[model samples]
Target: MELAAGNLSEGNASGPKPPAPEPRPLYGIDVENFITLVLFGLIFAFGVLGNSLVITVLARSKPGKPRSTTNLFILNLSIADLAYLLFCIPFQATVYALPTWVLGAFICRFTHYFFTVSMLVSIFTLAAMSVDRYVAIVHLRRSSSLRVSRNTLLGLGFIWALSIAMASPVAYHYSLFHLEVSNQTFCWEQWPNQGHKKAYVVCTFVFGYLLPLLLICFCYAKEIRDDQKSFYSFMPNGQSLRGCVPFIRCHTMIKNCSIIQFLNNHKVN
Candidate 1:
């Protein structure tokens, strides 16, 4: 009895033991990250599936058909998007989920480099497609001379080379850095100075955004103007919908192409 009382007293003296803490989640989760993850997942699924289908269809195109230049441009675009979706999306999505860069220096640099390269490839390919369309529609006779498999392939090679070269600076500029306050590491660009950073931004803006925008806009605008003029001249004024049908049919192709190019450029930017 005495020992039992002493044990009880000892237990009371020690006070109630604290409850074990609930296990922490493997990763931090919040509304913002949750939404981002969901969005990335959807994009990954749809983008991968769509791009894969396009590539497969294009690859299996009727043998000996000599795929059109537009098809070639589209194939390159799909390839670029596939590369972007495959390589960049996974790493990029991590930025929202994690607070630090855990992948190390090489992946950091490569991801950034390839991100820019893929984007430029897609954008440039869209620009090339616009030019091809302009040539095919506006200068029909010349298109026969200008649009050939060899030239399309050469253009694709140039786009890839230019993208790789232009994006090379990113690989050199990006590196892993430690944050003393957070005790975390981050992948970021380490420019030599503010001026260099500004210059890079300006250059990227001009080459990646402005030039492509100008080229696409110019090609489409000219094509539309020329088509409108041709349509107006072909159809008598005050004619029936039958007369309007031809213009509408012609404009529909241009409109669809414009929308597609604009959406692609928007995505790249």
Candidate 2:
């Protein structure tokens, strides 16, 4: 006992022992990650609920009542949004919450693939809807036969097939790999060259955003111009101009919002 005590005393005397590190607080969290998770959770909940409702209403239309072409487009849009919410949000949330990807290679690929596919489908659907509206309003007599259910269904199928084909590169490029230095696994696109990666980003932005945006804008602008011409002729003393102000402003606001959202989403990815 004495020898043990003497040894303990000598050990203590060998300079004051370094202080022990304080235990981490039990409730501690990364504030940024916490906030991100909360926001993503809210988005996922609202998106799923809203899209599900839209799909349900569209799907349950009374039997023998022919579905409108617009309803078909909206239904397709809702399904794409639902798919995005269900398949993409959880995995994307994990990206912000976890330090490294724990999901396997297939999930990593599928998540990115489906994300791109859904985004493309959504934007393309919007473009198609804009064109349909323009045709119905501006070229009514000329395009009457083209705006039928059969054509709409065919168009929706084409959209899905094109979206899937366009998003194929993501599945091919994204992969899970182990990093020796970080001692962690990550799911990322492994491009052969930096230039190729940039090219792909540029290509996706152009096809997914730029082209669709231009098409929507052109269709709406032409429709608005035609409507305004007829509307002004019917109204007295420029009353039509006043009436169009609010609509023009609303259109501008919506356009700005869409642009902002697309930019933000791309930045996040």
Candidate 3:
């Protein structure tokens, strides 16, 4: 009697007839993509505008004007920054928006190669400039001969050569990563041997970070010891370590920031 009563009360009484509701796939704004786009866009825009202005100012000089070694380095630095801004940021933004690497392999290799090279060149040039500034203040008399020898241009050429050597590996190793689950692609480096990746990363760290910091310190220490007091040294404590500390701290901060930005964007693991 109870079983008959139960069957009568329920709509489906053949078996366990009520089915679980299937979950609906979410369709909404992806916060990660949105944030990435916003940040990348601002960086791209500002980099282009600022670097372009720097390049232009350095490139166009008065008819009788001669550029200083610092100006030359500043010019090179601007060029590198400009190239990085043009090559990496836009394409990176492209991939973030797209589902895959639709532009194909040639660009996949060259874009990253150029970007890496430019970043290296920028960091190197900045370090070179710090050294040049040290020379100017400490050895102003000798700098006249260095200026005549066109050492700045020569140094710039050397920096570019070294940068290319450091960045060339990207051409061979970087490619699109196809994520099976999401059916999406990412630009990444896949090293054939893990040792190669480790070596490359270590090299980048030492050359890009450690060496630059050391150079900045050496330059500033030389500057402090020159004993060439200037009008700017108004305060007795003005020429102290606190004043010169920024040369080490700030310059390293810039180098570390640049290298970190490149490595972060590269997604190098």
Candidate 4:
């Protein structure tokens, strides 16, 4: 009877149990999403208005007039900024607000592609602007032929084409994934692979931040050097124009007069 009870107890303990936990909760959506929507909306509005003004100013100004390369850069930067604000930001805001990509699979793919392309183009254009400034100030003589308007346009076109190519993978991989949670349906990226996320972050930092910062630093350094040389060469007759002002004259006269009075007082003593 004891042996029989032991067998029964062992059987009860080994009875079928719950299965292991399955993959769940691929993404999170919450109040922060609402805040993101508001912030993105404001950014979109301001970017659109500012870029539109830049475009209008660039278009109304005459072309082929040997304008500053900086102006051309501003025009192209405005175009890229406008594209991001108008084409990308609204779609992103919608996605964040809905918390599920209600937009179809095609839109999901294309929207991601468009956002990436705009981002790349914007940064590359800024880099080009830095290079233009560097050439203009560091090698002013050589810059005359190199900084033509047509060349700037061509460079912008190339930047756009390269950006599109870089962003093509986004169109290829993105898809909507549906999940079940307590009888509710949730949609998110089909596969949030760690490797892909890491790659994206690294690529963004390299192209978006590091490279552009280096270019900006180079441009500013060249500008400072050129300005220093120009200023030294233009100084008048080994005397600083800044130091030869009426203020300095008055101070010098007061010092000389005080010295003369002190000398007279000493002689009287």
Question: Which candidate's lDDT is highest?
Answer: 2
All candidates' lDDT scores?
0.73, 0.75, 0.72, 0.63
| RMSD versus native structure for model 2 | 9.4
Clashes of 2: 0
Clashing pairs in 3: none
Q: Which stretches of candidate 1 lie over 4 Å from their true place?
A: 1-27, 228-269
Cα lDDT of model 1 by residue, 40-82, tens digit: 8998998899779978987776667677675677678778878
Candidate 4: Cα lDDT at 266: 20
Candidate 2 lDDT, 56-131, residue by residue in tens: 9878877786676767887887788788889988988888777789988999999888988887887788889778
Runs of candidate 2 with Cα error greater than 4 angstroms are 1-28, 228-269
Q: Report how far off residue 192 is in candidate 3 (Å).
A: 1.5
Mind giving the per-residue lDDT tens digits that candidate 4 earns over 141-246?
A: 8877888878998888899898888767567766766655534223233334757755755665566556776886777677777775543222223434243234
Q: Is candidate 2 or candidate 4 better by TM-score?
A: 2
lDDT at position 81, candidate 3: 75
The lowest-lDDT stretch of 10 consecutive residues in candidate 4 is 260-269
Give the runs in model 4 whose Cα sits over 4 Å from its true position. 1-32, 63-67, 182-204, 228-269
- What's the residue-level lDDT of 50 in candidate 4? 71
State the lDDT of candidate 3 residue by residue for 134-203, as single tens digits.
7666777776666542778888999999989988888989887778998876777789887878788878
